[model samples]
Target: METPSSDASAPSPWADAERIVLGRDARGGAVAVALDRGGEHGRRPLSSTELPVWVSAREAEGAATGRGIRWVWSSTAAWYSALLGAGVRVSRAHDLRLCHAVLRDAVPSASALREATAWDGAPAEAGPSAGALFELDDLSGNGAAGSRRPGRDGVAETVAELLRQDAAVAQAAHPGRMRLLLAAESAGALAAAEMRAAGVPWDAEHHDRILRDALGDRRAGGAPARMTRLAAEVREALGDPALSIDSPPRLLRALQRAGIRVESTSKWELGEIEHPAIAPLLEYKRLARLLTANGWAWLDEWVRDGRFRPVYIPGGVVTGRWASSGGGALQLPRQLRGALRADPGWRIVAADVAQLEPRVLAAMARDERMAEAARGRDLYEGIVAAGAVRTRAEAKIAVLGAMYGATTGDSGRLVPRLRRVFPDAMALVDAAARTGEEGGVVTTWLGRTSPPPDDAWRAAQARASRSGASPADETRALRIGRDRGRFTRNYVVQGTAAEWALAWLADVRLRLTRLAPVDSGEGAPRSGPAFARRAHLAFFLHDEVIVHAPAEHADAAAEALREAAEAAGRLLFGAFPIDFPLDLRISDSAAKD
Candidate 1:
């Protein structure tokens, strides 16, 4: 690998570059190329030991001189972690791995990158062995085919991919929107890494206390005390003292023997059945879930140094929403939120968007009536006020049914009224559903396309359309088609909502970095060296975000959160007269109450 130049008086190549691409040289060593508006200005290889210092210096210089630098790298997850570990943070980045996935699926026919399907593999995680950066399995069978292209792992390959992506975006049907989507998606990758590094403030004592209070005392090798008691109550009510409630099949048999006729033991079905054993059985199941999901074992494994550090996977879901690998981060139970306690002299600003999906639909469709209904208050209540439904409950059910393709029960029955009131909003989802039912793909507002129907679905449709197809075959095909329709119908709204959430997170992260750090004595040491003294994002759910900030900056953090929500709306919809109101709270704990 080429070494850093020895001339001390040489002008820095990165001094005026607007973008920099970082990758490994042929020798598996770090290399960076600076790019101005015209093209590449210079390229240099750096020792692994020198990489962090060089990046930090460039980042600091960029910040001081107002010369924003957007880092372009093969994978944010693989590269950003090392920089963050060394206390270096960048304002912007372009993750080629993530953008490749987006464009490959979104603009498959037009994207030159789609032809180079070696990039179609899963995202690279941190801590891989040296020289294994681009050694990913060929997942090109999904559509794109990998070429026998040499030098796929080098800096030159990365630069070439970046150029292809730029051309793809420029030639896309909605270039501006696609560009914004890629930027937001890349930002989410950075935020996910940063959030993992700076974990949520967890009060282990508080979490344990809550668990004990709810499930009774812990036991050595069995369920908690309250769970055991509830299990016993269920058996007593069923007149089967030795019954095993943990086994679904055995419990189903036991319930049937006790005259509780239910097909499944799910809580919803059990709640509908009025029996002496039902209440205790339900209680036992709830307690059992608590013990299994977030009990002592979970606490021991997930929490450390008063923080819960969960691994967040950006774009993990098909809808472009984030997913958690461990610690059930996305599935955090409301009961344990009290454990999300901030450090001393600090506060947590918790905010979540109100009816995010429905609001996104309204904005995407530009439905003026729906937007009016959503102005400054609860949307369901607004729908009720507009006479679309008799109650807020019906309005909510109808809106969800309209978006989710519900054709049965109360939700289905009330959807027609919503269609009449919000025709444009309903029409958008209806069209998406129709396209899905016909086995066609649908695109979100920002150009993230829904995955096409699989071969199984197409084969089923073909069987149903045969000359002598059976009625059963037809029925089965219709069911499968409608199921996919529901998925696609929701995909447009949910995917766009994910985009809005990313925009919100990216903006909030930038604004938080602008705030000055608190005194050293008041810093949250457990938040790691980079974020210990500053207001930084601590937790993010689909629509909710929690910021750990010093008490003195609580108001400012809350304001930034609200402003980011507004900015996200404008960024996605551009003055469409739609609002993304937030249910915000500033408190010492993240508990809803």
Candidate 2:
């Protein structure tokens, strides 16, 4: 309950603090609590109007004195967006909302904190207002009185949570890896916000042109000219002139009546059938997707002032990959890549890692043979050179099968060859699969533990073990168990790859900030105030990134992206001979040649 003395001349214990905790006070104002490696030392309060200036001064002072200040806040989306709006950027932050989710589920040593589910809530979306500093929604219905807890928004609760997290990390089975996971996860939150603020460069005219070229001219309230023609062709091919091609039920019934005898109306099923309507129906479906997903309506809604601003959710997926709530950032079709155009005086540096998951698997298992195979070339090609499979196509299928627990088809037939050639890597995934089948949890390379089986799964397993159990019960249990086994087999590799991507993004963001900003006259002002004059990240998928840089600084930005990737590799797997080469390009648009 003690507060910092208001006396102006009082010597402050937080003069050179290493970590600072920030939260809102009872009156909805900013509160700063300073801490060292020992513990909290002092606390101060600032008004809403003074918060920006205070942060700016602290950042300047920290930079001048060679002190790296890591800001601890409730949520990056809530706090950092406002700071960026006011032209203040922090190098590092500890997002309690994101970290709470990770620690509650993954860290066994943090059982005590897990019981307090007040911090378990979906991430706050970016909006005009900062809203509550700590909006503990208690979505799980476990908080006190089943009501909101405003006290958690204060500095005291923030400090308590931080202490609990630190203790959890220290007591974890692998403290070093747990710490790295938390840091990378937190950094990912920052990058997500920055990407949203600096939206991807889009050319509305070019987008419209692409749409027209594919779908023909746009109409006012109906399908485009080409889509209409395709729909007509599909109807005629089915011999039902008035049948609605858009409705699945109607289409399926029509196909059945037309002697197609298909069970479903899916494109894949339709493709397999030998019928006259197949090709036209497939083309109609493709054009319909483009029209509905990214048509003129989409252009009017999502893109604005030459930027597509999507809402990115960091740590959204259970495997630690990002998910977008709107704008379909992750699912940007290759057909639309050309619309990702840079500004007049800027260039886009697009880079994506090749075969990220398998390389991670090689480094994690320390399979020297697999690493040797992956030396300086495509992993699938390396597998072929090592005589594991006859062709690159077969090698790809076999490696994917091994990681995903595929047990049938050409993938299944080819997997044994890889198993013989790379026994260590095969053993790693095989063990993970076995653990999952036995209702056990597994952890990724950086300590992200998989969720425990639910009550239903446990009940099924128990039923299968009981005396006089029916064959149906045993079969069901075995099927579900294998399904979960496949999931856990892939989880470790995918989650670790996500961690690597986060590390790469964080390092690249830091390096880009160090590059000199373009002058006002030469800057791409349409990129918003925070990133208009500097090299900034524009988009990020799981293993790929696009940096929008001024034309003069394009080379520097490209080098930074490469260096960050190498740094991430070293940070994750020290001295491991695994390499992650990027297919990098610096061009005016994101389209590949």
Candidate 3:
């Protein structure tokens, strides 16, 4: 197996595996499969002293070529026992191949990889192989091999199947590369959208150059006239040729002229410019801007291709959460999704979680009534139905407050009633509040901790903790009181929500991997560009995700979005106490929300 050009110099982690296998068919094509552990199987180090190696073979001789190979990682569940049956060093190789297959089979859209640290303070695992350590079967497929057909809901089945095949191809070409490209494109797209939304002219070459530069690939001479012409042509075909550029200062001026305000913030060295879109354009540009400015281009370079591939950031967020990179996988910008157009003959069937936070709260609290209320209609309405409040408006306020710790008028007034109705949910909030009041820091679901109080704040807290008869004590008390209050309110809802998100992502990844490929009817391009399997849960925000789907699948990629969210719920909770829902959308026109 040839190491990718990018990984040639890096240490291979799969070297020590007992056996390695690549699943290929008679025609030498990849067959995606759903896997299940069925029973306790085995575990091993993600990689060995030798570099992780994977061989892609055609059918017939390929499967047997590397006999005595101790491990094999394929998308198909049939291989589970077959590899064991191979008698060679046939253990399942833990890496992007397996993880991607798992993710693809598990869900259509989003996937997650949990983080576990090794003793040396370095990621115990290398990349995908290092992160992929769990073994599970395909839950969506028929229990046995050669037993899957499009379900009654042909739409979903078709989409799932398409994803499976695409994923298999992606894994073979390069696990998790297509997605990286998409993530990068997504950033560019997002930036383009934001500029357009703010009425700023955008330049494609300039933007591409910006991205190239962002990745430390700045060209000495300016972009070529041919490149500029090509970009303009692309813009014209898309019906927006004159709007591309590379100057941030010029963009700022345009935005100012357009009556939009730009505010900049940074994490590490990444700069974030936030501004409100004109009411009509809000949805369209939100996501585009987010990706462009927030490391999307760099993510593309890191992963491969220009897709928004998912990067597995285990514990990326404080609360045991995972974040994605390229595709705005985490922070999906709802407005611009309509621009997520697909390739020829393909269409996106997008969906998303409805009231994800509330439902998670219901499950965490084990509040049966709340769960029942949430069973059917809008969650806010369900809150009303459960007597959590008198009306829809009140329910909305209460629920939002509960999750966000909003202590303003309506949110503050409704908190008490919410507490009274859902004790379990309230308990989390109460605990968080107490912690906050004491100046404790809160974390997200994945255990990514927030920075604690700085020296001055800590000192103030210390002073406030004592009996404050003096003026300084009084000042400290007030400061601590305000700080603690804010922390406590956000702690519980955010943390628990993050947990639900991680579980959701993990579940979706697993289930979609179990499904088979779509028939694609007749004459559909069997393969082309697609996202690499199990790349990484890179970038994330509240409820949205941007997966770097493979270019092969790019033409028909929107299906992944829908599949991921559905898988997320099923894998996390199944059809149970509550439902975790989502709204999935797609777009191709970057600036059109």
What ordering of candidates by lDDT runs from best to worst?
1, 2, 3
- Those runs of model 3 whose alpha carbons end farther than 4 Å from true positions after fitting are 1-314, 321-335, 439-457, 466-472, 517-542, 545-576, 582-593
lDDT of 2 by residue, 1-593 (tens): 23544343344555578888887665556788888887767678876556666777777667877987889987888878877777677888898889888887777667766765667877566531445645445422244422456543656666777877887787777889988888899998888888888889999999999999999998998889998888888889889999999999999999999999889989878889888788888998998998889888899999999999999999888899999999999998898999999999899999999999999999989999999988899999999999999999999999999999999999889999989999999989999998998999998888888988878789889999999999999998998899889989999999999999999999999999999988856587777778989999999999999999999999999999999999999999999988888888999999976
Sorting all predicted structures by TM-score, with the top scorer first, yields 1, 2, 3
lDDT of 2 at 14: 53
Top-scoring candidate (lDDT): 1
Residues 502-544 of candidate 1 have per-residue lDDT tens digits of: 9999999999998998875758988888898899999999999
- Candidate lDDT scores, in order, read 0.87, 0.85, 0.41
Q: Which stretches of candidate 2 lie over 4 Å from their true place?
A: 1-15, 127-129, 133-152
The per-residue C-alpha lDDT of model 2 at residue 338 equals 94
